[model samples]
Target: MKRLLLFPVVCLLLQFSYAQSRDEAAVTQAVENLRKAMVDGDKAALEKVSDDKLSYGHSNGNLEDKATFVGNIVSGKSDFVKIDLSGQTITIVGNTAIVRHVLDAETNDGGKPGTVHLRVLLVWAKEGGQWKLLARQAVKEPVK
Candidate 1:
């Protein structure tokens, strides 16, 4: 009787782990998509991947809503030359995913060239059968 109970519990744990792995992969892809959209300045992709109620916080303490965030990228106010994300980890809870990563990027905002290194935290939510960025915050990291 003890052995049978343990078997079922182990099987259930394995199944849950597998499901979690799949969710992690999906969230990772979503993060990559967001990076690509930023680098490519693709407004449509950005809008699609981000929720309308998004809260995008910059390292400089500036916060933007969905429309402003999209508008900045679309209007050349925010342009990413190259984005390199590393040390990424994603955790899922119910329909929400929390992602943390180190972001290093070359940027050209309004024709001013610069580079940024940041530690970023992103919150993504499942909506309409897809993952959308619900909120994001970044803190500037000193370059070594």
Candidate 2:
């Protein structure tokens, strides 16, 4: 009798672990999609991956709404020539996923070239069965 109960509990635990791993993979893909969109300046892709009420925070303490974030990329005001992400971690809690990573990027905004290195935190929420970016905050990394 105890063995029978233990079997069900073990199965349920395995099932839940599998589901969480799947969600983590989905959130990882969403983050990759957003990175590509930012580099390509694809307005449609950007809009698709981000929530309607996105709160984007820059390392310099600037904040932008969804429209401004999309528009800046599309208009070349915030251009990402290349982006490399490392040390990424994703944690899922209910319908929300919190992601953190180090972002190193080359930028050419308004015809001036520059580089950016920052630690970024991203919040993604499952909406309509898709993971969409809900919020982001970045802080400059210490000089190395």
Candidate 3:
């Protein structure tokens, strides 16, 4: 009798674990999609992956809303020539996920070449069954 009860409990725990993992994977994929969109300057992709009320903050303390963020990237005013991410972590709590990573990128903003090294924080929320970027902020990485 005890074994029968334990079996159901174990199954429920397993199901919950699977669901959590699935959400994590989805968040990871959403992050990747955003990276690709930024590099490619794909306006539609950028708009699709980000929430309408996105708040993007730069390492220099500049802040942009969704329209400004998307417009700058799409217009090549803030261009990302290449982007590399490392040490990424994703944690999901209910419908929100918090992500952190190191961002090393080559950029060509306003026709001037540059590179950036920063630690980034991203917040994503599940909306309409899709994970969308809700907010992002970056801080300069410490020199090694």
lDDT of 3 by residue, 1-144 (tens): 999999999999999999999999999999999999999999999999999999999999999999999999999999999999999999999999999999999999999999999999999999988999999999999878
lDDT per residue for candidate 1 within 108-137, as digits (tens), equals 999999999999999999987699999999
lDDT of 2: 0.98
Q: TM-scores for all candidates?
A: 0.95, 0.98, 0.97
Query: Global CA lDDT of candidate 1, please?
Result: 0.96
Worst 10 residues of 1 by lDDT: 135-144
Candidate number with the higher TM-score (2 or 3): 2
Q: What is candidate 3's TM-score against the reference?
A: 0.97
Which regions of candidate 2 are displaced past 4 Å?
A: none
* Displacement of the residue 31 alpha carbon in candidate 1, Å: 0.3
* CA lDDT, candidate 3, residue 67: 97
For candidate 3, what is the lDDT?
A: 0.97
Residue 88 of model 2 has an lDDT of: 100
What do the candidate models score in CA lDDT, each in turn?
0.96, 0.98, 0.97
